[model samples]
Target: MRRLLQKVLDKSQKAPTQDAPGSTASEITPQVMDGVGTGSEAVDNTQAVGTNPIKISSVQRLGFQNASNSCSHRDLGFTGKIAGKWYAVFGDTLWCAPGVKDPAQDLPGFHGMVRDSVSLLTNDPLTVVDLNLNNDSPVKHQLQFVPFNPAWGETNMYGFGGTSLCETDARSGTGAVYYLVNANDAGLIGAGVAKVVVKSGTPTVTQRYDGTKGHWWDAKTTARYGDVAAYRDERSEYIYLLGHPPSTITGWLAASYVYMARVRATDAFDLTKYQYWWGRQQGWKTKVLNVFTPETAVMWGTGQGQISWNAYYGCYVFVHLAIGGGTVHLRTAPAPAGPWSGDVQVYTAAPIDGGLVYAGVAHPYLDASGKTLVVSFTNNNHIEVIKVAFTK
Candidate 1:
């Protein structure tokens, strides 16, 4: 990765005018909101009130129904969304309906998982739903037979290291990444196995940033089974990948240590080439341990959010639920793969079984000013969005 970064730096020195189009020059400035309330609040027509006092301006619900007039399964969890469309991955089950749409009061898709050899009707299959939230029609396009398992910890469908959606490169369209999981030889073992499928359109394309040979790479050898987080730098030419190890605990449990890796867009996708950037292990201090407890396990089907790069500190930040408790911790790293610093307590709550707080993705939602960072999550039931302002 260093080699790739150096190569990019060298090219910039040579062709300073070769700017990547659509790259933003503006720095991402985040402001933490004050007086925000915490805990479950009432909802009045999509508005949520809590001790934090932060307002939920909008609400969207998604799920599919069976002909018998029942929800597919209660365990379906959405991990990530791109282009305003949500991707639901299955857990504890092998079958699912992928794309589901929710418009108005109607819910169209069934998002849940089922184990192998189970009947579709009797067994809960992992499914995806396609929803048109704008219209009054809540109908879903179901993609059935998606392979995922909570016991195996394969709950994400985005690209490896959680960088981008499962698609080709938005810039050159020359390379693409697909999400896939493989079971260890032990047969559908722990956390299963997560892998990224890489395809290069250009066979002999030299690294534009660095003059390195290019070839396809897999996440198994490259990224592995950690939480994948990504951010587009100000230049946008650099897309950083934060690969943390798989959660140690399973089924609503947490682990002690979290490790990360950083990969660049121009860099080839190989584990040997990837750099170990940052990590967090249990600390000795009570305050630190309280903030970085390895005790809580993320909900059975939630996906870690994309890490937002903080150029000011040369670190990245994302929200994670502390182990054994439902508190959300704001963890930071000096780099995507890091010797990290700062395990600040952000929000706290007791575990709410099958509640909205524990079931959704944690994504950074910028406010109207683009100055305040709003972090949001959704469980199967409700959605919660919080405004975070940094004092520094």
Candidate 2:
């Protein structure tokens, strides 16, 4: 227990000790707000969503629901440490209706294991966030649950392992590996990052940095897309990560674009070595604010997103919750930093027939045949997995 507590504290600081000498910590001022509160054991939102609960299990590779509704899955959550190893994405937001329940009431909200299928993990609140009294007030001071809602839920936190582990490259599906996951400060709006060894077959927590928000690649910034998807671009030998910077629009935190950032894959854990895709015609530029003004060539299918290299297509394929949220779209790029193609249709769900649907996950590992690609998403009642075949 002491080991776990210590690990959480270590990862909580966003300021990594490995940062390049003299690097300044991004002042986490306005972008992130703060909140902390109580939680009840998971509630049954299934009744509110009007769907009867079903059993949860690994779904088949293509377009079918995983029978895990009884577990109260957070549909749009993500996974961690990809170099093809089996790891869990530890933080997840609760599945909530548009206006039905206050998500903040989801104290031990958002926690799970994101693999080929979604698995309900633990909901132990670990990271802690002490926020400025008026999160929006220019005069700042830390307060308890100051800003009520926690952002970055749908896009949960996790990243992939690099070559350092188990001979894994950017695209390997399984390996003897290390998985570093950022579990959010449970019950808090603005929380620090707790770097837990989520899954490499066994889970452990090595460190934490609790002063900033819950993502290791990010500090407390108001608008950001986190739960970073990282991979080592064997071509460039530099590790590339597709990140989303989220903003609150019309009172909901939704995202529309995907950002690019890179560092030597060996330097994956060092925040200082990383560079951002500024989207200038000139491409990547190093900046300290860690901010980007123009987005990459592609826009997000849904605020929640995913990008993976599909060998069958011979390009990086991005799968997302299509604009309306009932379908998933696929776009391809020759390079990780892309001149991306517009999305080609991939999978469509029952929303066309009238029911709520969102959260799409791509499982390239399932495409053993190389001619087929796999994708998954969930409705309030069940998690669906789909397989896509390429013709010509």
Candidate 3:
């Protein structure tokens, strides 16, 4: 898969000066999709973002150019905006001390100091400023708000593997950002939540709901939510979450099923208050519902994604990667729990270092001009953003 995506990436980066024999200009020339100029021309890879076909105008890689010192931790660049500034949380960071050229070559896994990290996004979400770069020695980057206390035999390479940062509760200028925790490269054991307080301007994890049960944090269960995406609806005052079972669950990748659950924004920290959508017939229920069969699943093969309202499309848009495929996909729904539109291909991510593209998310707030959208994805090393416009 990595080789295949790399070839596509190589092809898209090339500029053919002349057409091949017997080929017309249309056949040999690169046609830009969505009419958005990328400075460098890209082959017309027709794809859709929701119902409208889109043109990718530009693609920019954010943060340190070298992998030895990335701005954010490895991958999972889902975003949140506080005080009009963008912030992103990353999982399992590896950084070399200053002057190190290659961490992989000099020290293995950056001397094995891997942990979840956070960063501040500036310059219109094109630059990453590592929040923990100034911390004391031994701390590579800004660490997780809540410290991980794993049981015996567990690795420390995981925390907030998949995270979603939503709005602060109106009651307080603070809120909780939920994520998948208790995981390693082997499997994700559970999901967790931490109270986040933005102090003087920086977001900090002050506390955690360690006692939550059921869907919140269960060491025995693998069907934890909040690992995909989370959003707080301003109009309804509900925190909607999209989730999928971890790979430890049988047939998870092959039969990927996404489930939707929601809690009142104010009650997001309480797991008991959550309710799951069981279609229009069964309605929302407290009891855990069965995974939607393939015929009934709203969206499937979604490993990671983000959901945000798109005023341009007049619906909620979901940008996610197809599990095991390097292709990014977009879907739309009238509401959070929906009768969703069919999947539409938007971008094909090129794999790096044997890692397929993951964590594709749309930053709706970054695009002021409603005509275009800003989206981001990563290969677990650095964040990449692209500007796209949808055709009417």
Model 2, 22-66: lDDT tens digits are 323344332211111123221110011112111122223443332
Better of 1 and 2 by lDDT: 2
lDDT of each: 0.30, 0.38, 0.57
Worst-scoring 10-residue span by lDDT in model 3: 24-33
lDDT of 3 at 186: 52
Candidate 1 segments whose C-alpha is farther than 4 A from its true place: 1-138, 142-168, 172-225, 228-255, 267-273, 276-305, 310-315, 349-362, 368-370, 378-383, 390-392
Question: Relative to the unseen true structure, what is the C-alpha lDDT of residue 287 in candidate 1, on a scale of 0 to 100?
Answer: 13
Better of 1 and 3 by lDDT: 3
User: What is the C-alpha lDDT profile of model 1 across 193-269, one tens digit per residue?
Assistant: 12222123111111211112111222222222333344434334444443322322223322223323334544533
Model 2 spans > 4 angstroms off: 1-25, 28-72, 77-84, 88-200, 210-238, 246-255, 289-292, 295-302, 352-355
At residue 79, candidate 2 shows an lDDT of 33
Error of 2 at 388 (Å): 0.9
- Whole-model lDDT, candidate 2? 0.38
